[model samples]
Target: MSFYLSLDDVPDLARGAAILGTGGGGDPLIGRLLVEECLKNGKKIEILDPTEIDDDDFVIATAMMGAPTVVVEKVPAGSEAVRSLRALEKHLGKTADATIPMECGGLNSMIPLVVAAEAGIPVVDGDGMGRAFPELQMETFGVYGVSGSPLAVSDENGHTCIVDTGQDNQRMETFARAVTIKMGGAAYIAEYPMSGADVKRTAIRNTVTLALNIGRTLRKAKDKHLDPLAELSAFLKDTIYGHGTVLMRGKIVDVERFVRDGFTQGFATVESFDGGHEMRIQFRNENVIAHKNGAVVAIVPDLITIVDVDLGTPITSEALRFGQRVAVYGISTPAIMRTPEALQVFGPQAFGLHEPWVALEELSAAR
Candidate 1:
């Protein structure tokens, strides 16, 4: 089935994408406004289910690469995403049949929509990651053997770089990061060209619908004066994301952050309202670990998200602040991410934590 996305869907879609962003993916605010403007200008974007695509359709994934903080200051030129896609298509000697989001989180989710609208191509209803990660190589597509190359990076000033990093997705990511930094810290990117059949086999299916469902659930809960967290948890139980657990609810007491390697690295401490217990979250774009009273509570490859308690809105790592009251939730990642091979790429070890991988369910049960 195919469906069109309108301005009316932006709010919910943005909200849901933020929740799945796991504290990264940048702020959805800028992306939302950009998308809304496109829609108001009479542009229409359609989303196609992965299963609906023909086996040989040429699909390219597009997104922005840089610090979320930088993306806000250096907004896209409104055509950067499409430009990058077109550039890559030209380099590949073929036009893309459709566009897909590299990941379904924060602003990246909206980028593909805007590009699809401008390019008159349908956006695939799935993504490389069901949730967000900090690096380009951390996608399910990459994990399942898809190359991340023949990429195009475009800046607001019309500057673009066509990259063919051979078989090293990591090298592609490193080069792209450096290019993004030099391009003023953010650049629109289009890469990972793959057949529709490959996408069906590797991508997380129905994630766009999942994000929409989550957004709608949160909105409906607020309207009905129900517990949005409970509603969110209930919805997760029925999805590939599995169960969601409230890791802690507290006021932020401290935050340590700095920029290194063109990325934001940091840790935040959230103390209970009564000042009794405290939880610490470490992050690299996305939350990587959670520790409560000196014991590990949650780790990477599982989803760790911070949400405004009252409104159910997700707060990205860049936006976390001291003195803010929030609730942290741990949601199980997709099953594909739990495999031994997948863990090697995104596990705690990959993030520099010397801890064995543990499932969110097990951690919650232990708690």
Candidate 2:
């Protein structure tokens, strides 16, 4: 099914994307404001289900790449996203039929929307990564054997460049990261051009709708004076994600974060209210792993999210601060994301963590 997004839908979508981002993907506020700017200018944004696209339709993923912390300071120049998309189309000698999000995140989720609205195309209601990751090749399109070449990147100063790194997706990410740093730590990107048939096979289906439902669930729960975490967990259990739980509730005790290599790398420590238990989360743009008293509790491909304990509003990694009362929620990734092939691309080892990848459900059961 397809759906249309009015101005009224932006907030819920941004909120949901933020949670799914699992503490990365740039700022939701920046993305929301940009989308609103496009809407206010009379552009209509349409969202088509992945199934709606014809087999040969040209689709591309659009996103902002760089450290989430840097994105807040270096705002997009509004035209960069659409400019990159057009540049990619020019290179391919074909116009884009639709745009899709590179990942499910605050900034990334809305980048495709902005591009679609400006380019007069609809957005596919799905994404390359079901959740956000720090690097370009971590997306399923790359993991599932899609080339991320002829990638277009645009900076705020009206400069656009194309990088065609053949099938070496890691090389593409390396070169792209260097360009992003030179562009003042942030740039808009359009990559992983695919036919609709490829999208149906590689894209994580219905993540846009998933984000909307999560935002709606949190809002309704809050409105009805229900426990937002409880309601959210129950709702997630019935979704493709299959499992959701409050991993820990505590105050952030310490944070060590820095912007380096065009990425935000850091860890945060949260201590229980009674001070007996502690959880530490590590990140490289998005949360990668969480250790509860030195035991692996949640790891990547799965989602470890931080939210305001009372309001259920997601707190991105850049926003994690000392003394904030927060709840760390763990949710299982879809089966496709947990496959052996997918893990080799984005597992704990990929992030330099030594622990073997473990499912959130199994970890919870062990606990």
Candidate 3:
């Protein structure tokens, strides 16, 4: 069923999207505020189920590219989203009939709502990645052979670039990252234009709804004084994510962060409150690896998230602070992400880790 996303839904949507971000995807605060501002200005955003879209309809996926910290400093002009879409449509010689989020995490998930509201198009409820990844080419759409070419990038300064990188998705990311760096570290992009039929086949189905449900579940759990972690695990187990395992409960003891090539690169260490064990996590915008007591417990392509043990709020890679109590959770990647081709693109090897890929289920069993 189709529904209008009102101001009231933004909080849950943003919270859920952040959780899906797996500690990357940028912080949801700026994106959530952007959507709220749009709503306050009387903009209406409608979300349509993928099944409602016609097979031939044109759908463009949109998102912000670059460091989340930079985005917070340089606020969007509010028109960047629609402007990028229009630029892409001009390049394609067809107006987008609808829009979809390239990823369903932190800022990108809500950025599409801003696009749909401004462009007067409905957003498909599905997204490219059920959760968020750090890179543009990490999505199911790219894995399923959708070209990332003819992309349009727009900055807050009204500068726009329409790029055609042919069939090389990696090249497209390279070009876009350079452009984003040149644009003062952040820019909105409209790329991966696909038919509704292709979107249905490649996109992770109903992730928007799933994110909303997750957010609502967390909020409800808090209200009822229930264990939020337990609630989240139950919710994930019933969905495509399969089981959610609590990897550890600890306090952040150390952090090392720096920006390289327009991306946030960092690692954090968490020590158990009792000081019996420690966990180390490496990240490039997202949590890419986790080590429990000196053993690799989880790695890329599997979802690694950290939440505040008290508030149940997700802790983004950029927001992890020393001395904060957190619970680390690991969830299984979608079935599509486990395929050999997808693994080649997102597995541990893709992240320069020499270790073989380990499924979250197996990791849980070993635990």
Candidate 4:
């Protein structure tokens, strides 16, 4: 089924995007504001289910490409993504039938909505990555078979570059990162142009709806003065993302994050209120690996998210600070994302972690 989003849904969507982002994908607040601004102008955004698209319909993915930390200080002009989409359309000599999110994390989740509204097009209800990933080539679209090239990168000042790397998605990331850094450490990107058939086959289905549902569940739980974490766990058990586990409930003792190689690279340390336990999560934009009491509790391809203990609102990686009381939750990724082919692109080793990838469920049980 299809649905429409109004201004009222922005907050819920943003909240869920942040959770799914696992501390990356840029700030959801910024993306939320952009979508709100669009809706405030009386424009309605429609979300089309992947199955609704015709086989030949052209779809393009839109997202922010940069250090999430940098995005905290540098808000977008809200037109950068639209510019990149238009530029990509011109380069391909074909207009996009609809826009899809490159990843369903943070700012990237909302970017396609903004672009769809501005371009007067609908958005597909699925994304390349079910959650967030830092690199361009890590998308399931690339993992399954879609080429991310003929990609467009644009900055706030109207400069746009189209990268045609043929089949080299990694090279696309390399070239695009250079342009992103030159554009001031952050830029908007339009990549992975694909047909409706490819989207149906490769894209994770219904994640936009999933994000909205997660947000609604948390919001409702809070409204009822219920345990939001427990509610979130129960809600996720039925989704593609398996279960959610509370890795630690504590205050942040330290956070060491900085923009490195066009990515926000760092670690955050969370200590239990009584100091009985500690968990450290490392990231290259998105939370990749986490250790609790010196043991690997969760690793990449699985979600490592931090949310407010009281409200259950997600905290992005760039926003982590000392003394913030938070609860860290580790959720399993979908089975499709754990396959041998998928792991090679986004698993623990892909992010430079020497340990082999382990399912969050198994790791949590062993602990």
Error of 2 at 2 (Å): 0.4
TM-scores, all candidates, are: 0.98, 0.99, 0.98, 0.99
What would the C-alpha RMSD of candidate 3 be, to one decimal place?
Answer: 1.0
lDDT of 3 by residue, 113-184 (tens): 999988899999988877877778888898999998889999987889988888888889899999999998
RMSD of each: 1.0, 0.8, 1.0, 0.8
Worst 10 residues of 3 by lDDT: 69-78
* Global fold similarity of model 3 (TM-score): 0.98
Taken over the whole model, the C-alpha lDDT of each candidate is 0.89, 0.93, 0.89, 0.93
Compute the lDDT of residue 174 as modeled in candidate 1. Answer: 90
Candidate 2 lDDT, 1-367, residue by residue in tens: 9988989889989999999999999999899999999999999999999999999999999999999999888888678989999999999999999999999888999998999888999999999889899999998999998999889999999999899999999999999999989898999999999999999999999999999889899999999999998998899988889999889999999999999899999999999888999999998999999999999999998999999999999999999999999999998999889999999999999999999988999999999
Q: Candidate 1, residue 287: CA error in Å? A: 0.9
Model 3: residues with Cα > 4 Å off, grouped in runs: none
Record all residue pairs in model 2 with backbone atoms less than 3 Å apart, i.e. clashing: none
Clash totals in order: 0, 0, 0, 0
